[model samples]
Target: MGSSSLSRWLRPEVYPLFAAVGVAVGICGFQLVRNICINPEVRVNKEARAAGILENFTEGERYAEHSLRKFVRNRSPEIMPSINGYFTDPK
Candidate 1:
């Protein structure tokens, strides 16, 4: 009974499902951490918000923008930036 149950749980066909679940969980965890720690619009103080924190920021402008966006904005998009820069740089 133990072997049968273990074999059923360890089937090769179930690996994809496990991979998908793991990817989904990783994405959820990343988003949760980002929202809690870095998202500017998540105000913890109701009073401060009411008083004037980010009052001038428009709704569209309030969302936290990833620093990567700014870094890539002026540069041409590349699949591997470090490698591209390494080869292209003058010695």
Candidate 2:
């Protein structure tokens, strides 16, 4: 890679564009894979949808009953809660 091209890519305005493009590509890939493989509806017929007959395991596994899920749900949705708490602590 030449310095000219590297410098062009490294500019401040160029980063948000790159980040946005990267995010868009990632989301598109994820959606495509999910629809093709993970989504059971992709294999189901219109009659199944109309009849409300789908996989029962999907509903059961959608929400986990594990202790970690419950613990996280009740806590603040922070990336680094411990670090945030440490900085904000009075003690």
Candidate 3:
């Protein structure tokens, strides 16, 4: 098609649609880069390993256990028995 015909077909109303698509594409590209390139490495605590808090078979499980132990340790002592009960008791 001629440039004039194409320009006539692509009206001003479609500019907003193009702008929205461009913004969406830009956001997706930014997130893709952020996830792949700019991701921060998680530093595992040496103390947790020394204390045997992360002795689980898998790395993910070990990290989870270590996080739970750290969470419990940081909380009040009174809450320990209840937290412990949740694991020990059936109900």
TM-score of each: 0.52, 0.49, 0.38
Q: Pick the lDDT winner.
A: 1
**Local accuracy of candidate 3 as per-residue lDDT tens digits, 1-91:** 6999989768998899989999999999987775554333332456543564433347555534565587778776775788788888996
Model 1, stretches more than 4 Å misplaced?
Answer: 1-5, 45-53, 56-63, 71-91
Q: List the residue pairs that clash in candidate 1.
A: none
Of 2 and 3, the candidate ahead on lDDT is 2
TM-score of 2: 0.49
Write one digit per residue (lDDT tens) for candidate 1, span 1-91: 9999999988999999999999999999999987766566665667756765565455435453456767778987789989988999988
CA shift of 56, model 3, Å: 14
When summed lDDT is taken over every stretch of 10 residues in candidate 1, the lowest stretch is: 56-65
lDDT of 1: 0.76
List the global CA lDDT of all models: 0.76, 0.74, 0.66
Better of 1 and 2 by lDDT: 1
Model 2 agreement with the true structure over 29-90: per-residue lDDT tens digits: 98798566645545555675686646667544643444578778877999999999999998
Q: What is the lDDT ranking, best to worst?
A: 1, 2, 3
C-alpha root-mean-square deviation, each candidate = 6.1, 5.7, 15.7
Pairing residues by index, what is the TM-score of model 3?
Answer: 0.38
